[model samples]
Target chain A: MSHGRPVRRRGRPASAERNAGEPATRDRILGSARTEFAERGYDKASIRAIARGAGVDSALVHHYFGTKEQVFAAAVQGAFAPAMGIPDLLLSGDREEWGERLVGYIFKIWEDAVTRDPLLAIMRSAVSNETAAAIFRGLISRNLLERVSAGLDRPDAALRVELALAQLVGTAMLRYVIKVEPIASAPAEELIPRLAPVVQRHLTG
Target chain B: MSHGRPVRRRGRPASAERNAGEPATRDRILGSARTEFAERGYDKASIRAIARGAGVDSALVHHYFGTKEQVFAAAVQGAFAPAMGIPDLLLSGDREEWGERLVGYIFKIWEDAVTRDPLLAIMRSAVSNETAAAIFRGLISRNLLERVSAGLDRPDAALRVELALAQLVGTAMLRYVIKVEPIASAPAEELIPRLAPVVQRHLTG
Candidate 1:
């Protein structure tokens, strides 16, 4: 990939370049942003560095993502894209087994390197920076929790969904981020059966 | 609150000062370490800064806590001191209601700003830095999980203890650190009942 080289055509207007239908370029910038934020964290990451990592111009990054916070938001969104199907997954499964399916699905996503990396970056940023935390909070509340809770038939659906999530999120932090032993090294098969029932009780009990 | 001024006695040997049996000074250094680690994180926080914060000489910090990592470990131990009674609490309670007691105890700790602040610092450091994470993992595994698991009758007692912990830890991250909505605002009275059962099941089910 080109590194820090401006790819803009000399005769083309910056606005035209900005509007150009280049999904690949936009995706590349986002990938770079995830890396930058992951490595340097939110406070230290800059538009120039992200552009350099993506082999695009700094101006293009600004045009595509708007600002540092905006760039971080887009990165969080992109990172969460894979897991966005969760609500659908929750709705499709047998209601009694939703806990198993939910736990299984989350474990699958977290177990893979490709998906786990960006999510890890997003998590690290959220824990350390208030701006990043707010963006993450908004997305999770709107995109994930709201949809899942809406599908539930219970009265305290939102609270229940959040509790179910707390179980999963806490497991992920121990198993992945903190790498606490036993929990970290234990196989998913061993954990799912144990965890799913508790989750099921929270959702359907 | 002295800032940066050395409090070493003139001509006194550092070893003699180190062994002076001054519990108050040692506690003050630990408190300062927690604040520095919480504010600057593990990687950015310095021994010099920690000493300065405690209003003690740098030599005294080294004497009391051998290295920056050692200081962090001591600080983590101090922060965790309050929660150390948990294993005893678990052993003392009726086996079935251990979950309620556990959840109640933890929420009480996190709800209080005095106990919560240092823990938040430890968590932030653990998530962001590898060395800090290891220290935290070791401490949690040895001090909390092992003690609790030892009292359990199940063969997978260690894993069970960890899962129970994951539920509370995840809740803490969302409710306290991330401050996610609904979960963040939901009163402890409401959360305790819903969460206690899951925790109970994990421990005894």
Candidate 2:
């Protein structure tokens, strides 16, 4: 499986054993963690199990990620990599148009299969388990909320950021995870216009 | 266990055995179903198990609510009874303050332990399970969306109502279910003012 790359047995740090600058092994471990968390949920997903799924020694999994919580964080970051730059995206354009840009970008992610799958898995696990939810919330706070709040320079920044997020996240839950009708079937063009203003108000007004 | 109210056996029709217009049996069954669904989730909750919880025969559960689906519907209605008359609530107040009223009411439900429990259970189960999610969406469309849309008399009324609902529902998921910070701890007074306008605009703008 290593393709002639030196394979370390148990207890050695993964980074020390792997070829320098090669993230393929780390990526493979994250992939396995994603599947494990999705299938077994947070409480049941174990480092040992994820290592087995990735076809690596359990020690290697620990060496790379340290703990299940860290593994979950890595998986969430990877799953949301497309949207992880939301802070940058929000700051790139006129802040007034933040709503349109934010909604447009999120709608694109939910509409596409490749990006949506990992997000769906993370959302499923998060809703069902407190541990997963903490990780999900942590990702949002660190990657999106804190950054957006910093840019706002307004009172109640945290509350405002969360409320705006709630709107988008809720819509995604209904449209994708729940498969609610109408909103679920409506084309993105129609939704973006209607929802953008609402998001904008939450963020700016 | 039935206290002399003619306990029906497993194979017998439940309604026939009970007195007409007496809803005690029906209410008891619904109560049991709520607990069962909350604890076990939709896919795992069974009529027999619910009957056992309610201290009645399985046939009685089937007789009151035909299937697990119907039982879930009953449980949902009961759990959401406080907010089910949202249309009436909307009409009873000044239409201009609709957003404030709506957000205030929902916030109360999430803040109170009595109302929040079942809702949290439903939200958690729905996010993780497709069956539960479908039921959750159907309830939203029938009870909230249809009524809100009927009052709009605007183009894209359905879409607008859903977006408004998404804001409130998403907030509830984060604050109550996921327990995300700030919004999760902020006083209701602070949030209602901020969120109400957003919802009102979605409805009227």
Candidate 3:
């Protein structure tokens, strides 16, 4: 963490410079943290190392984020920031297409290069670290599951949302970690049409 | 970790009596490793402390497990041993009832005191550590998912099994981690009847 400043107005109090480093320094930490956490994971990603990566003091890292746990929360959130917008795309059309829309949106996010690494890092790290695990699970439940649930008309929409996300998550785990063939390298688009109906069932049926 | 000797072995392995204090020493180290991995998680659990807890040479641990990664794997497998039997159970009954049988078995395992601890430890720790995450994910795909697929009658049973397991895993995560409402404490028989059909659709639908 090479960069340094006394106070962090990090995107809070939108009217001030407090929002200053919120963008650059925060993004800097997030990017580096993404790589570091992915490479070494939570136990190895020390505050000092993250600080060094950001060209900022460790104190500044703490000032911006209250604790290591908070920093992790921010990192996981930033990693998924790109895909977090997918719900809007999903909710845009008729409810019938919702299944395709939701599944396609998720497959696209993992398929794309820019967002893939960070998400993989989050996925890899969260299952092993308690703090990161909590944040990662929460991010999925809140951002993906809860957001998707809001668009569904069914009573079990929330459970369905979780079930759908689970499909994506479980498939990703098999494809990436277990190195399962066929499923691993198969195109996301190919999987979407097949899985969407099931997701849709969870969502509307 | 403590009740020395492999569960299936009729007598202590030759190495057990070679050094009278060794089994106690090994078990202690394994126990400490489990707790450390659980609390600090995989990346954070230090060999130094694990050595102190075991009252043996830290070098001995490295000699046995090779690295932190190996240590984590050993600990998780030991902790998660109860679940490995899932594959066997799924394969035992009539194939048509595999889904219900599998779900009921998992619920029962979680309900029982003996099999519960290691699973809970693995579930929580798997989310936060990479190696543990990999181990957890691998154990599922290799040991659990393959078995589920073998007994399924549907063309997409592979995907469906993945889907069904996702719900179970997510539900387990919430039950163990967040302790979410009555869902966490619900009896196995009651919960299985409700959840098994969803799994049945995944297996044979």
Q: Specify the highest-lDDT model's number.
A: 1
Residue A167 in model 2: lDDT: 94
Worst 10 residues of 2 chain A by lDDT: A13-22
Residue-level lDDT of model 3, residues A45-160, one tens digit each, is 77888888898788777877767788888888888898788678777788788778867777777777687778878765675566776787677667866676677655656655
Error of 3 at A180 (Å): 4.7
The predicted structure with the larger lDDT, 1 or 2, is 1
Residues A134-160 of candidate 2 have per-residue lDDT tens digits of: 888888888877888898888778788
Per-residue lDDT tens digits for candidate 2, residues B1-205, read: 4477565465654554554624777877877787777666566678999899888998767776787888887788778787786778776768788888888888877788878777777776676566777788888888877887787777678887777888888888888767888888888888888889988898777
- Could you tell which candidate, 1 or 3, scores higher by lDDT? 1
| Tens digits of lDDT, candidate 1, B60-104 | 898778999999999999898888989999998589889999988
For every model in order, what is the number of clashing pairs?
Answer: 0, 0, 22
- With a 3 Å backbone cut-off (N, CA, C), the pairs that clash in candidate 1 are none
Cα-based lDDT at residue A10, candidate 2 = 54
List candidate 2 segments past 4 Å from native. A1-15, A18-29, A44-70, B1-32, B45-63, B91-94
Model 2 residue A146 lDDT? 86
Q: Residues B35-92, candidate 3, lDDT per residue (tens digit)? A: 7776666666788877777776778777556687777777767766777777678767
TM-score of 1: 0.90
